[model samples]
Target: MTSYNKVNGKWTAENDYLLNEVLKKKWGFKGFVVSDWGAAHSTAGSAQAGLDLEMPFGEYYNDSLINKALQTGEIKEELIDDKIRRLLRVRFEAGMFGPQEKQTEGIFHSNLHKQIAYEAAVNGIVLLKNESELLPIDTGKVRKIAVIGPNAAFARIGGGGSSKVTPHYSVSPMEGLKNKLGNSVEISYALGAIIKNDVRIIENSFFENYNGKKGLKAQYFGNINCEGEPSYTRTDTEVNYLWYYDAPYWDFHGADDSNYFSVRWTGKIKAPKSGKYKFQVMHNDGARLTINGNVLINLWKDRRKSEIDEAVIYLEKGQVYDIQLDYYNNGGVSEIKLGWEIPDTDLIKEATELAKKSDLAILCIGLSDHFEGEGRDREFLILENQDKLIKEVVKANSNTIVVIISGTPPILETWVDEVPAIVQAWFAGQEGGNAIADILLGNRNPSGKLPCTFYKSQNDSPGFSDYQNDDLQSKYVEGIYVGYRYLDKHKIEARFPFGHGLSYSKFVYGKPQYALNENNKAEVKFTLTNTGISAGAEVAQLYIKPLNSQVERPEKELKAYKKVYLRSGESKEVIFELNQDDFKYYDTNIHDWQIDKSQFQLLIGSSSQDIRQTTTPKSL
Candidate 1:
């Protein structure tokens, strides 16, 4: 019932929400929400709901789906009217369409958002483990620095979503840090692990069992050659190969005809900066890399007969080196986690050392190539090693700061309390390194909240294993209750609740004023004032549940929410409108959305379960 994002080209689009909610409701949002992948099918209207433009998807506006929606009455023409009007409102608010500020043509493009992204990254970086003051590597003092690790250079950048923009350009951590340190800090590098697991396989199946269902929309490119040749190609058939692409118009036509093909290639990667480093690597299939133009990765490039097992390398500071690897997947599944450890920044090694000099230790641990950014969701292989690493790191160094960078939530229990601080750096785009550095140096206070929940373990989930492929037969097990709702109803506790995050600053919540008109529906107004030194946005969440109902119910569900930014001592009345629809849920028994006409409880809080204020409905 909620929405999920996807990646297409350079931007992220809302495959689910943007069209159904933003466009369907013609929502007049003052602040624009971003899109996640292939969502241009409904982009214009999305922009109307305060989503001015889709990120990285360039400036494309899908007219076909809009025309279809309008022609079939799937959407009303009035929606277009509202959309244009709402976009104008955003334009005015941004001083683009309004008389407030006459903008010069050149001013249309701004880099301020890039800075904002960096700052946001700094704030979101959760300090998971820090012992022996192993951080704040004063750039001025560190003479020889070794930045090693598959992720040290690899940019987990913004993930695959409609927001995924074919960036006009992008920056990786190694490049950014090298630019930051200059020649003062000598650095070494080693891709001790592989970031992307090359999956190659030769297998196909005929769906004689496939019922008459719409197959994958076909868009054939008919095999373009590497040197501009029309090489071998395959035609179409009912193979159900749902080839995913981000291009606006898939202009390929063909019938399913099987064909054979072969491809090859190679490249090199140099340790842009050199210091002291070592490798820790893994892989299920083939791959190759080179240092000093020597193959760091040496594997047979072919089918499933052999896999690129693993490789290691030592790093030296300020020494320019080269790297090259060859990879190809034959079939089935594959896995890889290639990381490096530089003597200067090796948390794992430092944590285990007996002669550590720093007063506090900061262990920067989280989803490396496994979580966040792209290749594939859940492709980052978040396994039991995560739990083990957390516990071991904290046990080795008590005063540790832990940071997690994942697109989704991971279980937490092994070392939550053993560590002093935790930060959630959710795939912050480019300049990720600077963001981490700034946060560690106290340049910013974190204000980002959990967009999803963190469970204590997978077993705590009712149906984690059967969720992906078991569609019709899949059972919610927990019923209508999800996330905080299910936990609250069953009195089950989560490692971290949704919308939970810590800030260096503090805030206060005033009692909410619930009011209604004769129609027995209205919005509740509340005042949220930030009493901290730094400015930040607060995501005020609204949850509702039936007081007395004839049907079964979960705990409270998030009905509506609003994010507001305010300065210290500045106060604004925040309002949340509650309508009949707000109280309704999909009543499958009646096959319609319905709202129970009875007493209701409203829970307002910094996050789910931790209610700071509550109220009983005065009406409806």
Candidate 2:
């Protein structure tokens, strides 16, 4: 919309060529195309190029602009009418002009939904390691339990950004264990270290009343340098702000859009105790922070949204210091966040001492919304401050269990061997804590399978820099060889293969058999028997491979999978259906998918790296 050679590398939403030729014409898409904020530039070009709706209230497609263009004959009325028709049809379907259903009290926090969520969490948890059958802790004998780590007492219910939601109730792991064990078992908790390093500075209790005045005094200048008198002066409680579009304070005050603008926030901060406080400043364009008129952190420059600049300052107990921050937005997207951190050093020692005395130690450590979320990418896959915490905890107590609560995989090689048991408890929603406690107490047998492979190192997987080229083209170079396929093809062993999961009980698999029906569909049959004391479920995975093919393909591809539950010593034969299209690969030259006329191999396995049976099927 702005220019072809611009940021985001000419995305299809903004590019006229791809939007018209590929989306509307080749794909025959009849749906409305919505432009993102600030994406639409030209009214005629965007409308003709297939944009149907301008999202979040648009500026270019306003009534005046479109009407002027239509009156001037710059664009046909049919084109404008077509866009409106699509929008009105969607609006009508959504019942925008119709009566809406009213919500009942306590419907959002229903107990029925919470139970369903707990069940889902119980099934989704995967046990990565359980050495010497240390799990299912003997609460009767082990009276003293130590729950320690960053997420030990915190309720990590959801990720950040749009996916984040405030649940009616969220039980922390420490609370869950205590409720499960009761007074018979004594439990203690310790937050060894902070989970996220970039904690925001100006929280609810950041500012103090200065001469009976609350919050910080903010002054907005018309120019970037904050020179002369401010255009507007006001007091604000919160410092962190983001003005992507439709500037709230400026637009209402009728401030100039161009020539850039600056804001100065001044306040008094009283330190609770004598210690070193870390202050962080993050901004899209430029910003600077000062304490007592001393320039400590300065990052005033024309830069994109970047990692925050941090500075540590010593403060005395009950002492008040004047704090000032200056921020300027040079157009485009604007963001500013001022945050501070207070170190909790003594907790690590207390946690170690507690672990040394406890019979069993539960280390709840993993990623939070700040680290992995919807709009943000992970800076590092490894657990933060957990590596050192794990080593320290294990050194004090040999009977320790490492419980990782993350939505994505974290590198566990740092202290995997030190701990006796390891459980991967993903973002388990509101009832995650109770679900994790159930698995620990052996109330539920862990049956969840890994949806993706866990690489030993970040280098073993695909590189992010190579993910996008100089031309901004995202090339899937790995192609069919993603996850376990890539690891298997390259002979790079994974820390845990795709679909891998452990259960309290064990299972044995039998040979697989297949027969082609009249419709040329393959019906695969296999038997899985539970061989352990506990009743559990096993995911039976089936992968297909073309042994002799003209085009290069993965070593194998997962075709079908089913979770089969069996009681102890019980066996069940599972059958799956597969058509010819399941084994076909897309030919780029022909622009169509085609099946090969070569011999195909069928593999049955619990995990990608743990195959149980294999068979060669006749070509159709």
Candidate 3:
């Protein structure tokens, strides 16, 4: 047995040993366990338990270690054979070590795949605000359209990490509009603000190969000075490097010796504009930055944690400048970030000029992969500098349509009121541009509803400060009061309630009807009618509320939803069934799910806040 270590005020053992009793035996898990990178700290204990494989590279599951364990009888021979059999079984089932299949040409970028992608993008677009029917732009009357903002030309198809995929081609919002409008409409584009501070070496066109190679050249030294010849040299594909829980894979030494090491990265960056650019470096321990043989930032000392250091420098447009970064890690966690913000004085000027001349300004600005992605949390809930850009663009042209391209609901109190229209365009895939254009041009009716509550600010959330804890202890103190439930229970109003969306056509709902079914389940029925001129889809939401219950519960919980398409003056009936699981709540005293024999309220509406009809139904 291995000794335990104290972490977060609790004694923690290696998961390789803990998982055997918990997952394999207690839970009856037949699947083998694969250890995370560098997670297997022991040889005998881990193998004696249920650990089948060590990922990436095996430090403990080698031949010598297993032989020693087998000779000492710490790990039985059957365990080793069983692990190998499981590995081979999984490999055979996955077809990895089986008969190979031939690849088909053009299958990767087939037309059918592209059409599905386009359909998904258009269907997911949610129309949040359309004041006075400002959308459905008149193509005959509108000749000039100014596509303004940093995201106007930027094609954010997906986020970072594993989700980052290089599509065959991506259509930017500007391109989509142009392709849809054709030669009839003249479109102008302007980057309203420098949304992305710096581009990555692997992705961005602004970064060139440092040593006439593909990526930035990195030289690693064992000592702190980075003197003489480097112990190892490699090319780093990305500049945004973070090595906290684990260290980088190097040949010279093991990860345990990562405490005292130095690295220097040399790269070249091309400036897109001629202005003062802000260079920033976020790092733990010590880091230094230099550009064009000049030391821009020097924070080469041990920092308690991670800190950001920034400096400003003027550069010429189209000229590639030499960039270098020196980083050293001295124990604990390690992280280094190298990025720069482009000068923005000319950005506002260009946007205003384009907006004044155009008939309408389409400001495509919102969060991107840099702000929201895997393993990264947003620092601020509000979209930075977007309010200023919106105000400036709206001032120049009152006929402005603000489109927010983000995965989650962004804070919109700053300039939401000033704009005539707002659209929530989530990280639409390869055909996002065409979908957005279709919605703006009225080629497609927006019907997507908000899945989560859109709060005015981060402070409005019930668990805002308690989201992440450092002590490894998290409590769902809010319980059933999450998202819209929290707002509804506390009588707190959100910027936009959950299940809220707008269509070109108006929808009216009839009184909700409910009854107990033969299966002892509750069935809710309602009718919806499109009372407007255009054909659209309406999402009828059904929420369950307890009229009287012994246990504490939320004001209402959304149980089921149905989206129905209706032509002008068309009506349709929606039916949803709720089972025993829907009415049952966890009873602490009984230690099981329980349902109180009481009257329940059934709600039907377009949104959580816009309940049109409610009726109390008797339970079976």
* TM-scores vs. true structure, each candidate: 0.58, 0.74, 0.72
What does candidate 3's lDDT look like per residue over 230-314, in tens digits? 7788777445655553344334452337657778988887888899988778787888888999998888888856667888899
Model 2 lowest lDDT segment of ten: 1-10
User: For residue 44, what is the lDDT in candidate 3?
Assistant: 76
lDDT of 1 by residue, 1-620 (tens): 11233322222343334443544445644444444443443544453333434545544445765676567775666756754765677777677654664445543234775677666676565443334434434555545443333344445565543345333233545556566667765655433223344211101121111133321112222321112332322221121111113221122222121121112222222332355444433443444545566565555444332233434566554443433223323333323333344445533453345213333334334453334444344621343544555565556545444555556665567567666666666666665766765655445545567766677777666556456664434445666666677678767787778777655545778889888856666778888888877675677888886888767776678888887777766677888888888877678786567877767888888788668888886675
For model 2, what is the error of residue 547's alpha carbon versus the real structure, in angstroms, after optimal superposition?
A: 0.9
lDDT of each: 0.51, 0.79, 0.78
What is the C-alpha local distance difference test score of candidate 1?
0.51
TM-score rank, highest first?
2, 3, 1
Off by over 4 Å in 3: 1-101, 199-345, 467-472, 518-520, 589-591
Candidate 2 local lDDT, 322-342, one digit each (tens)? 999998877755567787766
> Which residue pairs of candidate 2 clash?
200-339, 201-339, 201-340
